[model samples]
Target: MSMREKIKVAAARYPNQRSAIMPALLIAQKEHGYLPGPVLEEVADILGVERIWVYELATFYTLFHTEPVGLFHLQLCDNVSCMLCGSEDLLKHIEAALGIEKGETTADGLFTLSTVECLGACEMAPVMQVGDDYHGKLDAARVDVLLDSLRAIAPRAASVENTSSQQPGE
Candidate 1:
């Protein structure tokens, strides 16, 4: 669907046009995989709000990718608790297994490795999140298994989705 069509759909759902900013941005991101400046402006235009308002919302949420991200976003926690539990080793294992450096996406755009301060799962230290799923108490072997499974499964899952239905804007 076109960006204009997405905006119209979002606008129809909200009581006020401005309230659709987040949902509109999400729709844009789902189509493009990230929030580019032009798309943000488009969303702002649709919502009849200032561009900065859309920009602010996008920048404030870590879940909203401002730039293109790989198919799998691997978020590893490196905070005090996770660090004490050997998150560094887990990070290295993931990097080596994926053949990509930290803060880098793989050549195939399959994976992106990123370190986060805290995931707020201290009890499950040395945790990593792939997409929306979390894997806790990771070791090298577990990380390998997790990546393999995700790589094998994600594409099939994505293909099975019915594109005709619009995803609800988170």
Candidate 2:
């Protein structure tokens, strides 16, 4: 189904139109990779809500990305629990390994490293979130292993992208 249809269906679930802002944004982001100005406006238009309302929710949440992001987004939890459990050191190690600091994507656009306030997995402190999966109780070794695995997966993801982008005749 089209994004507009998906948004309408999602909006139907909520009594208030504003409540559908998040679901609508998620649908838009999944279709566009990121929520650019035009895409945000389209979502607002489709929902029959104010543009500011869509922009407000899209910008406020970390899950929604307004700018382009890499194939893998590495989010490290830097809250007190993670801090005490050595997230600071882990962050440094990841920066060195990936050759990119926080808020930056790798040269190949494979990874984007970021530090979030929390992941709400205090029991499994020192956690890193790559996409939707959480790798917790992390140390240098675990992080290294995780990075290596993601690297291996990158080529397959690239190939999939290339395949999907090809025209039937071309």
Candidate 3:
């Protein structure tokens, strides 16, 4: 089924099509990793709303990523608690280890580092979210282990994908 069809099905659960904007956007974002301009326009078309409305929501929510992200999207918290716990130094450590600045993905596309205002766990100061998992009370040692672990497994994961994609003769 097409993306629009799937979104329409989700929208059917709502009282009105407009009420399903969040689900529709989520469905659209899932179909495409990130919501580019064309994807936003298509979502607007699907919902019978202005393109700007879709764009506004896409830009407003931290959940909806506008650009393509790497296999691991790392969101480091920069809230007051995390800042006081040295999130800035943590950010630098990630950048140096991943060889990419904040808002940038690595050359191998394994990691994307970005900062967020909060991750809703102030007590877990100096916390970072890798995908859905959260690492709290971080130090440089933990960061090294985290990056090393991912880097070590990334090659094996890629090889599995590569092996699966290869043909019987090619």
Find the number of clashing residue pairs for candidate 2: 0
* Each model's lDDT: 0.83, 0.90, 0.85
lDDT per residue (tens digit) for residues 72-152 in model 2: 989999999999999999999999999999999998999999999989999999988888899999999999999999999
What TM-score, over all chains together, does every model reach?
0.80, 0.92, 0.84
Model 3: lDDT to the true structure: 0.85
Q: How far off is residue 157 in model 1, in Å? A: 4.5
Relative to the true structure, candidate 2 reaches a TM of 0.92
Model 2: residue 41 alpha-carbon error in angstroms: 1.2
25: Cα error in model 2, Å: 1.0
Error of 2 at 2 (Å): 1.3
Of the candidates shown, which would achieve the greatest TM-score relative to the real structure?
2
Tell me the tens digit of each residue's lDDT in model 3 across 32-91: 767899988888888887888788889987778889887678899999999999999999
TM-score of structure candidate 3: 0.84
Candidate 1 local Cα displacement, residue 2, angstroms: 5.6
In candidate 2, the residue pairs with backbone N, CA or C atoms under 3 Å apart (3 or more residues apart, or in different chains) clash, namely: none
